[model samples]
Target: MVLLRTLRGPAYTRILGIGDYRPARIISNEELCRHIDSTDEWIQDRSGIQQRRQATPDESVVDMGTQAARAAMTYADLTGSDIDAVICATITHPYQTPAAAPMIAERLGTKNAAAFDLSAACAGYCYGVAVADDMVRSGRAEHVLVVGVEKLSDYRDLGDRGTAFIFGDGAGAAVIGPSATPGISATTWGSDGSGSAMISQSVSWTEAQERYAPASLDMPGDPARPDATVTDSLWPFIDMQGPSVFRWAATAVAPLCERALAAAGVTAQDIQVFIPHQANTRIVDTLVKKLRLPDHVVIADDITDMANTSAASIPLATAALLRSGRAHPGDLALQIGFGAGLTWAAQVVQLP
Candidate 1:
């Protein structure tokens, strides 16, 4: 097992409550096949994604994030004013001017609360959770709202098979408060910036040509190589290195999982559930085999029904499991996230 370098910190921060919001409108694979050149069978075979939920045309990232925050605050029996801080994770926000988190706090009526946005790609929620856990544990804040919300479809190139079939829209959230024991036990986290170039969104400018500049959101194409003078033509859409990502995810997630389990002094058998990032079912299955955890460990994922919600995936699945009575109070649960940044993290948590 991988060992910790620093002594374990006190368990003073805990996840007190959680909530999620999925748009009422659903997008099925068959419907996508009609719009794009894809088949339900093919999409399932590649990513195990059968369908997705997308926000209404009128809904936006901040709106979804705010909505999820409200639900979490209600569950925590706290008002926006009660929260000392807020951290929102999203790759897609409506505008580049005003940060989404502060706007959400305003919408939630949190007075003078510190708030900001975070982007660790799909691994954002894990990172955010870790950040909030620390801030609260250090007595910097009492109650913090860590939100993972995304609207990937709004910027998607619906015609591309790789990305279109992989993303859906939704939001998930958690209210973290101080806990005495069995709260956030141990977490393993790391990132590789070199991999950040692999996935992104971009825009360009033209010399002395105002007409050439488009104000609308545009996809940032892949980075240029010195050897290849010819950069491919630009398109507005998402991109993925399917095979590389799958490999990285499978290999990257296992170590973090092992470390977190060890830190909690819990065996794999002690874990009541494993809520992995909802990037792909294939990756989850691969890790399940690698870890050799319990067959009844109760792995939860909603990608088949909700698609990949990026940072929102794990918390969304966790909340859904709780709502359905799958994950009960005080149960031992583990969560892991891995994606762009080539980042990954794992933490063992106790249900409140």
Candidate 2:
């Protein structure tokens, strides 16, 4: 019989640094009102969003992710060669074959890092963080780059009022590495497929291609509309059942957060900051009340200016919190992410 030697890692893992990229273009509620029959006041009252960022036509998910990754690496004092793996969490990467991770790694100058993409929808960034934590703890990788990015504007339905004002484009990245003390705690995560339809794409890729078949390809455009094209009909858009999602997020996620706190051996009193996914301001308010957190715990409200960036929300908000000096190194933060797939994940960590 042959015996194999095992590798040992550090005592725990911690997030070394964090960074994010908000698009240069801002789309205010007034501008969105032109396409949908919504008033600026009604939009603000409903979602607590005044404006959101939108990337230009030329910006791709990789471009935004790379910029964010570079910033995180710089904050961690790491170069491209220092990364042992890259995990990109996004559903908006256009290419279905080659994943976005390798492209980002190569662009960052990594010659041979393990790379892959994760599709957990809005729960993706937390999912990536958990996986990276495990990898470092197990000695499978020394340093991991986790990025959450989305370019939802490319698939948005301007005429659909339900989601037109809810989504924005952005990217956020974090570097996870070995630590002397425990910085990341046990994560509590789960999913419910029964509510999967609550949020989803308007059509499948096959359905979109079928709609663009030759028989329907050559239809004449209205004489009054010279800019109309066949490609417009083939693009899939995001769709959601707002009430159902709100109910799930507001009621169900609170208990999940409690479980995460318990798993980390901490209570609401020990946390200094709370960064939930920036899905909506109302949702954040409900969770805060449900958790009964003390007044000193600062809750992230980036939704007012950033809208919902899906997987990028938590880290983006984390970066904003740190930049504002509301959170400092070694401060305890409770982070939770929940969205499509009815998926949810939460954990407690010390701020970088």
Candidate 3:
């Protein structure tokens, strides 16, 4: 007869620190108006974005993510060698081969770190945080770095007013480690595949290549749409139905936050901060009113300056709030992320 092995119990986990990196150059609405028909007032009134950061020509997704991870490690008082796993959440990675996470880990000197990329578009970071936290709780890793980074400027169609002024580039990171008490509560995550088409790239790379190749089929520009000027080549950029996304975000996400709060055994009044994805100010405003969070609860609106950085928005906004003293260590915060995949994830966490 063989004896049975004892199983290890799940450990508690919490975020240790957070960091963010924004590109050096800032592009204002005035600058964007030069290429698109939209004016500063219209852009501001519609999206509440005055300006956004644009990555320098030399910057790559890995470059921004590495900087972000390093900053997070520094804040956590740990070096890359201390990290056991790295999870990068991004949609703008340039290459189809060699995912961004390993490259970032190597640059940060994390030798043989378990690294990979997670793609859920704007909801990627929240998904990453949920995974990282679970990894720690399950004893799969001691310290995990979750980074949300994007280089949306590379794909933005300059003449397309819908997206031209709405995206930027940046990276944000958080270090998750063991905690004595529950720091990150159970996550509330789900997806609506039916709405996936509401946000997507205009065309796949292979299709674009095949269609735009020499001696390819006729692919003329649309005469009706002012910005559809490409006659031969097509750049696969992000496209979305703005009103549709707004409606889904405004109506669906509030209940998820409530579920997350309940999972954490907390209430809206108990939350000190509300950090939803920085998609737009109007969405933020709608969520705030619907949630009926107390007047004292701080709400993040980094979209005004950072624009929508996709996967990078949540962590970036969280880091900004903590760094600016709008939120503090030990405060309870509710974080919700929703986007492409028509995916969403929410959780209540105690601030590091």
Residue 127 in model 2: lDDT: 92
User: Candidate 3 residues 15-106, lDDT tens each?
Assistant: 89899999988888997787778899999999999999988767899999999898889988999899999999999998877999999999
Model 1 misplaced regions, further than 4 Å: 1-11, 202-236
> Cα lDDT of model 3 overall?
0.87
TM-score of each: 0.87, 0.94, 0.92
Q: How many residue pairs clash in all the candidates, one count each?
A: 1, 0, 0
Position 93, candidate 1: lDDT: 79
Instruction: Summarize candidate 1's per-residue lDDT along 1-352 as a digit string, tens digits.
Output: 9986643444578888898899887878887775467799989988889889877657889889988888888888899889989999887775666889999989999888999999787889988989998888766788899999998776565556667678889999999988776488767788898876556553332321232224222533311111111111222345777777777777878877888788778889998899999988888898888888887788887888999988999888988888988779888888988887777777888876
Candidate 1's TM-score reads 0.87
**Cand. 2 TM to true fold:** 0.94
Per-residue lDDT of model 2, residues 222-337, tens digit only: 12123323233435777899999999898899999999999999999999999999998899999999999999999998888889998898889999999999888789999998
Q: Weakest 10 consecutive residues, lDDT, candidate 2?
A: 221-230
The prediction achieving the highest lDDT against the true structure is 2
What's the C-alpha lDDT at position 1 in model 1?
100
The lDDT, on a scale of 0 to 1, for candidate 2 is 0.88
Q: Give the Å error, residue 201, model 1.
A: 2.7
